[model samples]
Structure formats: structure tokens, C-alpha cells
Target: MDRRSRPKRHEESRENSRRNPTTRTIRREAIRLEDVWVAYAGSGKPAIREINLFFPLGKLVLITGPNGAGKTTLLETCLGLLKPYRGKAFLLGVDTKSRKILEARRKCSYVPQDFMKPPYESYTARQAIELGLVLENTPDKNTRVEWAAKLLGIEDLLDRPLGTLSGGQQQRVYLARALARKPLVMLLDEPFSSLDRETRKTVAEILRNYVDRENTTVIIVSHDTAPIIELADTTIWMNEGKVVKVEAK
Candidate 1:
């Protein structure tokens, strides 16, 4: 493979780099799944159990499991939407369970598993994506929105109401919003579950380019593996609420 064309699985593991990076000095741990288990408060069993996973910044990791394996719960925990009953979930090196952790979440973005544009979020695709920048008061809001729209190949739908878009189109717009922050980390759940293989591949290639160059960490949850099997740097297999297998690609 052409060195420049390949993605860096780990910064230190690189054959060469523009600058040397160290484990201790990473900007922040994008994600850490340390003995983490999440259960709805009062529930007996955790949705996922003992997930000891570490994802470095700038790489893409894929999560695979059958339905009810707790894939959505894992993504929710990473986004701080769910608190683990046992173990810890960290975002950008800070424990996300803290009340003050909203700041930590600001550096993260998510395209939820449900993939629906919420009620008030029925804005046009561009409007929804722009809201991400508006909430952050980003300096170049228009430029950022345009970039995300173009990157996702949804520039044509920029003015279309999200409700009118097809499932695939809506998914792309959801991705636009999640990526609007140029976030340090992104959590996407079943992003391609509905798309055909060719379209899925195209989207995957676009995301791969973004993460590889911008050093963004992307953790995607999906039961489908045919498209992303080769692109992921790490793959975690969930079974009955536990990570039964982990393979480094």
C-alpha cells in the first residue's frame, strides 16, 4: 500500500510520521471502555458487560453484534447518554458521568441508532447541520455547513426538509450534523444498515478520508459487516451484553 494512502491505526505504530507522538501525551483519550457495564437503573443485568476496549484518536473502530447484544447501549454510554452501573466511560480523558461533563460531550457528536430527526429538528437538512455550528457559535458557520453538506454529497438537499428525504438521505444529513462540530470523536450507530452495498462503500470511503486526515476518532455500531470489514482498525464483537471477541484489523 502507498504509505500516504493508508490510514494510521495508531500514531505510535506508524512506520513513520511527521512528528513523533507518545501514549502519555495524546491530546486526549478519545474513548476508553474499561470494565464498563451499563444497566438501566434497577435492572439486574447490564446491557453490555466488561467491555475493556481502548480506541486511539484518528482511527475508525467498528462494533458488531446481533440484535439485543447492547450495541445501542454502548454507543449511548460513550456519548454520556447512559451512565454505567459499573466501571467507567471517559470522553476526552474526563469521566463523562459528571454533571459538568457537558463540556466533554461538546467535543463529541453522535448519530443515534434510531436515526430519526426529532420533532423540533424537522428543519431542512442544511438547517439541522447549521444548528450544530450555531449551538457552538462557530466562527465560520456557513463555510462549515457547506463543507459538511458537500462532503456527504447532500448539497442538493441542503434546502429540503429532513422529513421529505429518504432514509439514506436522512442518514447522510444526520451524519452532517454529527460531523458539524469537527468533533474530536464521533459515535455513529447503524449508519449504513439501510443502504445498499455500493452506497455504503462510498460513504465509508468519505468517512475514512476524514478520520485519517483530521485525526478524528469514529466508533460505529452496526450489525452489518460486509462493507466495513476491511476498513476498520479495530472490531469488537458483542454477544449477549458482553464483548466476546475483539480483532484488530
Candidate 2:
């Protein structure tokens, strides 16, 4: 083509580019479980059965149910800490039973239901929080710790030994640890169990803010949902190891 024709072609290309801009597709599921069933050793029944669940990115999910309803089992199964006896569990698109599950877990932060430390344990609250940051090689770890502590109203306890603190206090410390990591996925099992009403509200606000600002995918298991119910994008109700209801707000 001549130079004049080349100029016209370039103009057409620019118009086409404007009309068809390149776009990236984001994966919807941060965690997925397909027909999962988890059973304890020598147990006659599965702890969780016929479970199929998906947690999308950038949303807060609340899992609520009575005790012995298999809420904890579901969370553990999603993290690959408990293998599904009958089905598949995936985290960040990687199968939970695969070797790459470790890599997938690096993008996750978890606070278990029992966060209390033994009296003989020696790590300070600040040090405990540091553990989460270590997996990600996060820079400015100290600053992140401070920020999380302050957010959780635990700044004064940073230097206190974790084992020396009360159960409620320990819960806050562990929550701060999880938040400091800034993980893409966060799983908290009965995180507010030991917290008082006021602290529960405060922590719930912190979690809601994190989800909004960071687009973090959060799955929280709690028997009490008042604190977080308004903030959850989805609420899952479980009974007898099955998800009986899923309500989207």
C-alpha cells in the first residue's frame, strides 16, 4: 500500500482498538467444594456430607449453624487440613488434595475456633502476628502488625505474651495476625466466640471494611450472626452436616 493508504489503515486500526479494548476475565470462585464428605477415623458417619459450596472473590460470607453442625469441618476441608472422603475441594482453583495446595494456601489466612495459647507458650502478641506475615514475605511487617493491632483494639497488648492473655484477648491477637497478612482469602471459625458484644461489633466492622477496601474473600463461621449479618453478601445455614439454606443479601 502507498503511504497515504497506510495512514488510512492506521486510523482504522485505532478505531477498531477503541471499539474492542482488551479485557481480562477474573475467576469467580476463590474456594469451591463439590459433593464433599468428610469423616473422622473409625467414625460411622461423615462429619460433613453432600457439600457443594463456592465462595467467590471479594465478598464476605457468613456461615451460621448450631454446634455439631459441621461448620468447622467445612472450613477445614476447604483449607485442605481435612481431606474429603467422597468429593473434591479446591482453593484458588487448585485441588485441596494436590501438592499445589500449599501454594494456594499461601494466599489464605485462617483463624481457627480455638485460638487460645497454652500458658507455657512463649510468643508475644506481636510475634504471633508476625507468623502470618512470614509466609508471604511481606515487607514492612512491623507496620502491618501495628495497623492490625490498632484496628482490633489490641495495640496495648502487642508486647504481652499470648499465653498470658485471656481467651478473648487471644482471639483478638490471632485476628490481628490474620489481618496483617492481607491475604486474598480469609477463613475464620467462630472468631467471636470469646469476644464480648462490643468487641464483636468492632471486629465485625473491621472485617467488613477489609472486604470492601481490599476485595478480600472472607468466610466466617459463627453461631451469632448479629454483628456481621448486615455486612455479609451471603449467609449459609447448616444443619446435620448439610447446608439447609443459602440466603443472599
Candidate 3:
């Protein structure tokens, strides 16, 4: 390199140094499961058994398991969607299956594996987010709606009909609707099932920042390991409905 270019390179190096943080700090515990077990109403075998886990607050967690291995069952139990056959699920420091289930869900958001809405009804991306806030009876619904749309980069499609949007656009809108509540935790089921590789990476990157900035906990269920491993702080691998916890380096 020439002497004249050295100064410019030095300045660029300084800019990068100023932008990087060498250390990461953690502040709280987000999800804690203790000796939990879940079984279907009519099934003889348990879906998830003797599970124990502690997740750092604001951390992104990836959950991977085979079909029928209880990945869905675990998310449902944590969000108080299912009644546990035995043991406990402590989410946000409260028993998830107790009377507080409704309240617990208020601060939690979920996106199912598939997106299905009633036929013949028209909903714009913005309207769908608005409806979610209304369903939760959240105050400042408009602000929440605006923020959710913008955060997911769907503000440009606010007036576009949900059915008219592209697959990636539709997924982002679904994400915005879940984010409308400004929940403390987000549970996603098979988020990458239908997305292409680029969309998968983009969505994963956005989720990583969201978890960090909001101190929000995210637990995502996916069989695709690449995106999950790239974004997760820790991974919980399940087989036959049992979790194998490990810190990924």
C-alpha cells in the first residue's frame, strides 16, 4: 500500500475498533424448566420427560428434534398451552400452567409452523398486527402496531393484503403480529420450514438483534441446524422427547 492510503486505512481501523465490544454481558434468567414431564390426554407415553433447563435472559435458544419427538409439546407447555402430566414449567418466574396462564401469554408470543387464516376474509399486514394487540387488550395499540411493523421491516407493506404478499413477506407479517405484544419471550415453531436459504438467514439475523436489544428470550423449534446453530447461544437437542442441553462454542 502507498503511504497516502495508510492514513485512510488507519482511520477505518479506528472506526471498527470503536464499534466492537469484546465482552458480552448477561443480566437475567428467562426460562427455567424443572423436572417437567408432559403427556397427551390419550397417550400412554410421555411427550417430554424429566426436562431441566435454564436459559439466559435475552438469549436466543434453538430447539431441534425429530417429528413426534415433543418439540411442539415443549413449547406448548412453556407457554401454558398444554397441561403438564407431572412437574413444573417456570416461565418468567411463574408456574406456566397455573391461573396466570392468560397473563403469562400476554407477555409471550408464538408463531405456529403453518400460517392458516379463514378464507374470503381480507386482512392487510398492518391490520393483522393491530388485531393481535386488540386481542391482547394492550394499551397504546397503535404505537405497538407501528413499532411491530417497522421492526420487522414490513412498514412498506402496511396496506398490502396478506394474501397478496410473497412468502417471505407473509412470514415477516406473521412475525410482526407476534411482536405486536412486545412480549418478553417469543416461541417459534418451524420458522424456516418454507423459507429459502436467504430468507432463513435474514430472519435469523433479525431475531438475534431483537433478543439482544429487548432482553427478550427466544426459543425456536427447527430441524434445520444451519440457521439455528448460527443464531443460537445454546442448543437443546431432543430425541424421543428428551432434551440434551449444551453450550455451543
Candidate 4:
């Protein structure tokens, strides 16, 4: 082979390596906050202050604190829904403040504290679950909806209108919706608020299984941690908008 041809062949080999699926790298931190602070309008103090936290992939993290302790603020900051007054937040290696964060946000699913709707609102459990996949244009939408409903033990409630269901039932439907997305990172706020003791235990086991099977990151905010405490890899306690302790369990 000619010398010129050898260089060209070497360049082509390098290009092939770059495009190889096996060569891809994974970021270690699924969610990270660096000295972050977030404040509400008309409030002199920040809701979360000088927080530095890291949540790695494929682990269950529990955040627990009293009301007004900024657990909600911390979750929102991680998702880029709340802008930081100082420092930075990153989700899946994408800076939360960056415009490109939308791409990262799409890889996450959130179930907020107030997911229940009024009795007059009319949307079936199946329809609500489908919406999560629909928003992302996920393929095999029907299959995913069915899978989520079954996983959450809500198959019987699928055709029932969400408003007609009890608060606990509605919570399960919303949780199914979040799971249908197959998200890389899950942020759940007060997920077990309305659940009975038995249902809470079931949901906690499901969440643990999800993290193990999918290799995803899960961050949960709850006042009652009994159901999920055993499954947690790390527990973060916050008070007055500051993380008072982070313990590995």
C-alpha cells in the first residue's frame, strides 16, 4: 500500500471507532448541585441555600424533612424548573440553566406532591398514563401504558375516571403515568401521602426493583420514610433550606 493510502485508511478507522456503539461513555452523576440557592418571588430568603448534593445512577435516594424545609425546592432545582440564584445544577451532565437542559429533562420523570385532581375533572386512568408517553412521542405507547398499570397494580382501575377514584387510587394512576415514561431519573415528591400501609409497601418495592432493573436514579421526598428506608442507598435530611446531613445506609 502507498504511504498516502495508509494515512487515509488510519483516519477512516478512527472515524469508525468514534461511531461505534460500544465506545459510548456514561456520566457518573445523574443529578448534581453545586452550592446552589433558589428563591421565590417576593421572598427575601432563598428556599434552598448553598446546597451541594450528588445522586449517582442506579440508586435510590431519600430526601426527608419537615414542611418548608426546601425538599421541594431541591427537587425542582435539580430538574431546571427553578433557576438558581447562585452556583449551578446539573441533570445527566447537562447544566440545568443551559438551554440544552430540555433534552436532559426529557429523560426524567416527576410525580409532584399535588397530583390529585378535582372530582369533576374527567380523564380515565389509562388516558392519564398514556399522556406521559404521548408527550415524549414514545413508540409502543399502548404497550407502555399497559405495563405501567400492571406494574403499579392498577390494571383494574385503568378504565375508571381519575376524578371518581379515591385519593389513594388517583395517586397510583399518576405513579403509573410516571413509570410509563421509563425515565432515566425519577423525582417523586410525597408519593405515598395518600396510600395505605399495604399499598405503600408495595409501591416501595416496585421503586426498588425499577432502579435495579433499569439502572436509573430515583430521588424521593417524603415525610414518612418507613416504607422506603430499607431500599435507600442514601438518606438526605434538610432543615431550614439547608442539607443538615447526608448518611449512607
Candidate 5:
């Protein structure tokens, strides 16, 4: 409170900001839904109704509920894949209903629940991961792909045909593909469904590290939240097409 120390305090504050710029900038929500309602084609009722949610950047969010809880619908709506029939949805501040939503979606990575390949399918795991690097002529594409594969403990499987691998191996390859992209936001559905308990914990930690180092947002939809509940910054519980509870750590 000393007037004589005011200039010193200002100098210290500026130094702190210089050390960590994120502290000086206001954190913003990466996804927001306001009174949203979404339904599939030919469906008279909305799968997710009267939903309102917001998630900030650089956070890991978990969405969990029972089988018919509409978790997947809400996740898709966040990415603008499912248009809300009754209200507004936004991704990174862009209106979901706008044509520009396509551009917004390019900044996100999505992994759906069903990623199994047919037994005869032949795409190598490496090739699948490379596809995620949509940007052509990227000098570091190989490095990124390799790093992601190794990080997921699938480097040896990279050369194997995706369909020849086991279900858990295929899942790791898909996750590697997503991680290699390093998108601003990640929308993952049941990401750990195929992994064993040990693998699930490892993958969750890897994702947490990614969120911390890259300062990106990850939203996961899962029926089993045990693996990620401890790492989540926020958890949303849904039931009967509605968000019943939200817990923030």
C-alpha cells in the first residue's frame, strides 16, 4: 500500500506477465451451447434437448452418462456436425449454424466411438496417421506422426495393416492420428472403450500432458468416467437428454 513502492510493484507485475503471457490474457470458452436441441433425420424428438454448456480453452472436459443420455449428440453438436433445431450452438465463438462452421471445424480433431476396420482392410497405421496431417508439404509431418505413434506405444504397429491389428491396437492408432494433428480442440467419443485398465490410465495421462503443453481443449464423451474423472477440469453428467449435473475442479 505504500505509494513509494507503486512503480516497483508495476514493474514486477509486468515481469510476471512477460514470464507467463497466459496470465495476462483472459481465458475464453472454446465451446458454448445455449438452449440447444438436436435431432437426427426423420426423428420427431430431439436427442439432446434444452442443453446449455460452456467449456474453456486448455481444459479437459468429460461428458458421461447412461447409454441413452444423448452424450454423443451433444459432442457432435459442439463440433457443428449436428445442427441444433431449436437454439444456438457455438464452437470457438463461431455460430454453429453458419456456413463458416466448416472452417471452424477444421481446427478440431474428432474420434468417434466406432473406429473398427474390417478384417480385409489394408491401410497401414502410419498411413492412417499421415492422413490426419491434412496440410500438404509439412516438413515435420513424419516427425509428428512418429512421435504420436510412439507416444501411444504403437510405433511397432505403425507398419502393420490397420485391420490386421487387434481392436485395442486399432484404437491406439486412431488416437495417434488425432494427437498428431495437434488441433486446437479435440472431440473424442469413448476414446478408452477398447483399452484395458492400464492402457486407459496411460492414455488419459498422455492426453492430460497434451492439454497442458499445447494449451488446447479436449472434450471426451464416455460411459465410463473412472479413467478420466481425476484428470478432468470439468465433468458434465447427462440424463434423459438433459445435463443433470456439472462438477468443476
Candidate 6:
């Protein structure tokens, strides 16, 4: 084309660009770790080494392994609760090492491996659940809390002191607390540890439905995977602080 024609073409291209703006690639993963390694204070060796993971959005992922497999460490590292000494970790596209990690974490929920309350703890189940909304400004906070409790069959225990409940009941309360937030991501450690077979099945169903309904990314660390395996979209196996296998449905 002639130089005059080229300028006209360029102008047309710029106009088209302005009309459509810019199109960027959609992020597929909510959590990603690139060759991550973590070590606790005074530890002889790293808890997790050379860990690489990618958890796609709206997927139910299960991390399963025997005790001492660094499952808990992996979960904490993903949330920036434990920073990686080497490599990188990202949550919802924000680097875990960045100062903005906390801001990214606000959109997520975590249920630790130990949720049992001390006997002196006086918070009721409903109060414990409501605490999940403290950082949020939801107009329907009470409705969300009640709905989560009812889903876990813990509405009756709403007024009961958390410390006074049975282990399984407390576990349900904690689960309800995390669910009530409607977080974009959920990291649950040993979610079925204290539940019976029936309760496990029920909780699994509830989680599956929640993920489907909310399009939330859920990463569950469980030594006992039978209850959640069927519903999980991906399963990651770890041993000796390394991912040994990965299975996806």
C-alpha cells in the first residue's frame, strides 16, 4: 500500500482498538506455586520442597497424604500465613510474598487443622460463625451465617458455647464459619477428621453443592479422602514433602 494509504489503515486500526478496548487473557488458576519451599524456624529441613501446584478456579481440589506429608504447610503457604523461603506462591494472582497478599487473602477463608476451642472459650457456635464476616460488609450477614449453620445441621447448636460442643460438632461449627463468608477461595485442613460416616457424607454433599453454586475454589487437605474424593475435580498426593502424583476427574 502507499504511505498515504498506510496512515489511513493505521488510523482505522487505532479506532478499532479504541472501540473494542483491550482484550486480555482470563486467569484460569486461583492458586499457583512455582517451585516453592518452606521451612519452619529451627527446622533441619524444609517442610515442603520444590512444590508446584496450580488450582483452577471453581474446582474442588483434595490434597491427600499420610501424616508428616507437609499437607498443612502447603495450605498455609498458599495463603501467605507461612511465607516461602524459596520460589514463589500466588493467591488469586497476587504474589504471596507481596504486601498486597493480605488484601488478596481477604477474599478467602481458612479452617485450620486444629479448631477445637478451650473449655474457657465462651463464644457460641453462631458467634464463631459470625466472626467470619468481621472483615466483610455484607448486608445479609445474619442470613448467610444462619444458612451455613443450617446446611451443616448445626442451627440447633447456634446458641451453645463452642467449647461445650462435641469434637464433631465443633468441626461443623468451624466449617459453617468458613462457608458463611462465601469466599472466593477456601482452604480446609482435615475437614472430616471429627465426623462420623453419615456426617462426612452429608458434609461432602454440602461442599459439592456449595462449590457448584458459588463457583468457589476449594482446596482441602485430608488424610481421609474417601468422603470427598468422588466430588473432587482434582486430587494431589504428597509424600516426604513432595507431590508424588496428581489425579483429575
Best by TM-score: 4
lDDT of 3 by residue, 1-249 (tens): 599999998888667656632111112655778889989878888999998888767889998977887888888888788767788886666677666556557667888877755444389888877777865655688888788788777899999778777767777888888877777889998877767887788788888988888889989988878776977988888989898656665
Structure candidate 3, residue pairs in collision = none
Model 4 weakest lDDT span, ten residues long: 20-29
lDDT of 1 by residue, 1-249 (tens): 678645655554563333422222335578887899888867776788888878889989899999999999988888788888889987766676866467667777888767765445568988878877755765788888888888888899999888888888889888888876898888899999667778799888877888899899999899998677689888889989988889986
Assess the local accuracy of residue 133 in candidate 6 as a C-alpha lDDT between 0 and 100: 92
lDDT of each: 0.81, 0.88, 0.78, 0.89, 0.90, 0.90
Residue 127, candidate 2: Cα error in Å is 0.6
What TM-score, computed on C-alpha atoms, does each candidate reach?
A: 0.85, 0.87, 0.81, 0.89, 0.87, 0.88
In angstroms, give how far residue 203 of model 1 lies from its true place: 0.8
| Model 4: residues with Cα > 4 Å off, grouped in runs | 1-26
TM-score for candidate 6? 0.88
* Number of clashing pairs per prediction, in order: 0, 0, 0, 0, 0, 0
In model 5, state the lDDT of residue 82.
88
Model 1, residue 88: distance off in Å is: 1.3
Global lDDT of model 6: 0.90
Residues 1-249, model 2: lDDT tens digits: 488799888888778657633111125678899999999999899999999988888899999999999999999999999999899998877788888788778778999987778997899999999888776665689999999999998999999888899999999998998998888899999999999999888899899989989989999999888889888999999999999999987
Q: Candidate 2: which stretches are off by over 4 Å?
A: 1-26
| Location of the lowest summed lDDT over 10 successive residues in candidate 6 | 19-28
